[model samples]
Target: MSKEGRNANGIETLAAETLQRVMEHPATQNDIATVETQLGRYPRGMVAVGARCVGDGTPLVVITGPVLPGGIPFPTTMYLTSPEAVKAVSHLEADGLMRQYNEMLADDTNLRAQYERAHAAYLAFRHGLAERLNESEEHIEGISAGGMPVRVKCLHALVAQSLVMGPGVNPIGDMALERMRNEFDPTVCRCVRAQSDGQETR
Candidate 1:
């Protein structure tokens, strides 16, 4: 199911968008520290990835792209060069794309083996993200390393902010989304969490 959002572009749009967001994620040496301080990120307990939650930003990369030929290694990948931004994939492709991704996953013996080996990791991440969003707080960020432009990053933010974890993924709200658009910079946007319980998600 498609969630409502300011943008409706598909994953093809997000592939390039991912590259663009990386370009805008310019983090100075202190940006991560600053964001961590602002978010009060502290680890609740012993987690394998982060030493502590408070000081660390969970890096999530959404591999939003086409299901490349199975022969290619890493058909989809993400970059986290931007210090300010964590990671993101397009509102994730729709069910169709996911099916194709899985189909390709089954075909590529090496990749399929990798997917099996990492299947637990994938489920854990999804579980963690769902838990995080359901329980306390969660924010979305997209960044690029090549410096394509800021608008691409903002577009990703738009998609991320619009997402909601409901019976099915959807958009949060229109006004909440409009609130993020910027006339200047055009690409950079501040993602605001929709505290409303019945809120829609993209």
Candidate 2:
């Protein structure tokens, strides 16, 4: 498990499991349609680089964890030590979430429920899907807005697959840590790994 008590892969697992829940739950289509319609209305650039959606009707579910944005090196990067290094990487995702959330909050202002529900769904799926993946408890994002609550729904990863988007660490050895920064790319298949039992939905 990564620092902040979460599994490294918890995020993706959450999305997948949540999609499954959505399918089983009565709100599947409506929720998905709303998200899709918004996505379609959204400029292609926005959705491709920054949007993330989950839930499809077929017997398949795909958890899509968005590496939406944010990646600033701590001012003292070179001299950074162990726990510090860990914390730096650990909180990276949380930092990204807020970057997006703050922007969303400005417009929605009162949409805390939406964010919380999304987070709760994310957490639930993380736990449930862990059992499915046979992976040690993994943390999706080490931190989320530090604290927030929303509707909670768990996904069933054992019943779904996962798709992630992010960057690649090439042998540009010099670009080592630099390569870890977020690079939003819709067409780019960030991570295409599949579930053993679940179909290769991604």
Candidate 3:
């Protein structure tokens, strides 16, 4: 994969082809089971475990298909499933981080361009999912999460995108993840009790 671009946070973005390869990996049964435990329910249209909590090595983010079961057009393809991660990101949101990010987008031309690329990368990932699942892109075309290409609506969505696509792919996502690292390091295992029934398989 070639280095295509860099965000304000110094995170290098992957080329569209590289992003596709990274997000197209298949999910294992154990990965799905752990995610189910995290969400307390079955995950629909999940294609891969995009990111894991280093604390417990459990799945924290999942790459879901554009269209889930029952013909539902799922817009947020990268879903955050970890309880800790969700809570941490929610805290950032509650602190007015979205407004801050949007202000950055408005003031920084470089960041806005990088964010636009992030949107493109997200669409490419979704198209890859559509190809693998034999689904059409008609419903999900041009739709990317976290207000990509224009705004930053949700840090959770942005962080999920960064986790799946990697750092520079989503500047805002990278920023969110960076902020939450101190409170919730995904590298450390923290789900010992949560995974005791079957043990951590991620």
Give the top-scoring candidate (TM-score).
Answer: 3
Clashes of each: 26, 11, 12
Candidate 3: what lDDT?
0.78
Q: Over 4 Å off in model 1, which ranges?
A: 1-9, 24-26, 42-160, 163-170, 173-175, 178-202
Q: Which candidate do you rate higher for TM-score, 1 or 3?
A: 3
* Model 3 lDDT per residue over 84-130, tens place: 88988999999999999999999999999889888887776776667
Q: Which of 2 and 3 is the better model by lDDT?
A: 3
lDDT (CA) for every model shown? 0.28, 0.30, 0.78
Per-residue CA lDDT of model 1 for 1-202, tens digit only, reads 3432212233224333333443344343344433334334421221122111123333222322121233222211222222223222222222133344445545666544433323222222333333433422122222221111111112232223222111111121112224333421113432332223423233
Instruction: Give per-residue lDDT, candidate 1, residue 21.
Output: 49
Question: Model 2, range 1-202, lDDT digits (tens) per residue?
Answer: 3632353344455556444553343324443333333223311111111123222222112232222124221111011111212232335444453344445545563465344443444355444433543434323443322233421111111001111212221111112123223541223334333333323334
- By summed lDDT, the worst window of 10 consecutive residues in model 3 runs over 5-14
Off by over 4 Å in 2: 1-110, 133-183, 188-202
